[model samples]
Target: MKAQGIEVLLVFDPANMNYLTGYDGWSFYVPQLIVVALAEPEPLWIGRGIDLNGARETTYVEDANLYAYSDRYVHHDHRHPMDFVAHILRERELDNARIGLDMDSYYFSARGYEVLRRQMPHASFIDVTRLVSGLRSIKSPQELEYMRQAGQIMQRVMKVALGNVEPGIRQCDAVGEIYRAQMRGTQAYGGDYPAIAPMLPTGRGTSTPHLTWTDKPFVREEACILELAAARYHYHCPMARTVFMGDPPKRLVDAAMIVADGVQAALDAVKPGATCEAIEAAWRSVTAPRGIVKESRIGYSMGLNYPPDWGEHTMSLRPGDRSVLEPGMTFHLIPGIWMDDWGVEISESFVVTADGYELLAPFPRKLFVKP
Candidate 1:
């Protein structure tokens, strides 16, 4: 950024906040905070008093200005949070500076935008979200290790959950068992999202790839799909597997096998210099013959934050997304087949390498039928 003449960087979104400072909390309802990096000086953090300790402990920023409000008081009685943030920016003499703002992830509320506009009228705000995302796309060694651990845990939980699968079990019950199994380990917090809410889909419900868990129980020869995320040390590894309640109908099994083949083809295509479009095409080659039309990208990135603020949809799987397959880049390959009354999905996490990719989860892909 120094070579580009960028003087300061301001990060305000929750996702960016977590990325830069390990301050992970749902910040929507809370007062918005900003992490500012000046070219010469130490970084500064502007946040509410409630988050002071957390911000200090997790962030690299040493200078922190905090605004507090009395718990018993109403609006007019305390110092305004936005004003404090503005004051910090002004005190740093960053007004009129070329400031990089993470616009992709940071959306200012109407009032908050007005406050910044009034306070820093002279500053030019440039969108730097892409720069930051580009930097974040590749994982650090520590981040990769955490994701690998997350994958291991997910694989273990999958074994337990699949072993308990049977025709009589409700989808929700199976989901509950998986969640419980995940929680047994010390690393399990909540998932990147809810751990197991939209757990496994059964019967006709499998038609929707992201079908939420239902009270519907599994029946003989029906399709059942389990989509899950395992989070360890805040990193996530998302995976899915489809199975049968009994001996699955021959058609469903055939579809599952086709999807599995697509997944394998995608994994085989993953290597340095391979484009995302090329990977998607490999999967499409296998699925197209079986009449399974892909409506979404073949895969997406995985990281400390699953579904990292950017997703496969936002970053297309086209030729332009020349995000070369690099070592330490973790992604989820999800090849799905949508049918009239059911769908089959097989998702696995993989980390790109110099020659090939490493499969993070070692779970079985075949239809596991419960006796």
Candidate 2:
């Protein structure tokens, strides 16, 4: 904030709110803010009166720094929680200070921004998008440990998904088994809810990513894509694999080999001095010759997050992203191809080591052909 000349930062992203103050709750349905100021030693947590105690229990913030608005402000037409936030800013003499807002964050709703902007017209608001998230890109020792545990859970989760997806099985039933594996986890520690639900795109649905399940049963000779994650303490480790119910077509077999090779080439290109785009170039070199031209990025930085997404939104493996690679940075290298009526996906979540990279999930990086 000192470098950006932002005197006050209104942190609305729940992951960021957790990163700064260790405040975690499902109260983000309404308005909430972590009022961070240069003058104050402790950041203030402002939210609904009902969640005040939750913040006190989950966060290290002092009682004096925790403020809550009455029930009237929640979903009320006459008032908003930002009004209460503005009053607090006035009390701290920060009403006129330069403020920073995460404009692109999913949690920072437009109505909330409009209310805060209208309430504090004197303050200069800067769009500091990805500022806090960038800080969270590199994993700390403890954060890496949590992610490793999440990866261990992911190994079991993926095995369950691969085993459950077979001929004559309902897509919903397969996902049910997956959910049980995700929640029951290993005998050691249980799993937390992933930011994204299990993406079980089957047959034609496989041509497009991000589709959930249906009651339809799997047919022989059709393909299914299993994209799922396992989380531990809010830290997520996601993985994807393709499954074939019967004899695989030669076209898909060749494509799967190309994807596997491209993924490995990208991983082999990782080093301390390499850029994000260079890693993408390595994958492109392998795919361009095979007539695969993917417009979407192959990989992205990911870690601690909430519902809707698990990516860090900081950096990505694509053309022109010149972000330098550094040790301790984790990424999901999901290089997939979706054609007109068929698709194949194979991915790996790995962390950058000092010399190279290490795969998080100890699973096979190949398409599973269930005969």
Q: Among these predicted structures, which one has the highest TM-score?
A: 2
RMSD of each: 3.7, 1.0
Report the lDDT tens digits of candidate 2 across residue range 227-273.
99999989999999999999999988889999999999999999888
Per-residue alpha-carbon lDDT of model 1 for 46-135, expressed as tens digits?
655666666767766654343333333223334345565666778767766887766655344555555666778887777676565556
Off by over 4 Å in 1: 2-5, 26-31, 63-83, 106-111, 186-198, 219-221, 306-320
TM-score, model 2 to reference: 0.98
- Give residue 326's lDDT in candidate 1 (0 to 100): 78
| Every candidate's lDDT | 0.68, 0.92
Q: Candidate 2: minimum summed lDDT over ten consecutive residues — where? A: 105-114
Clashes by residue pair, model 1: none
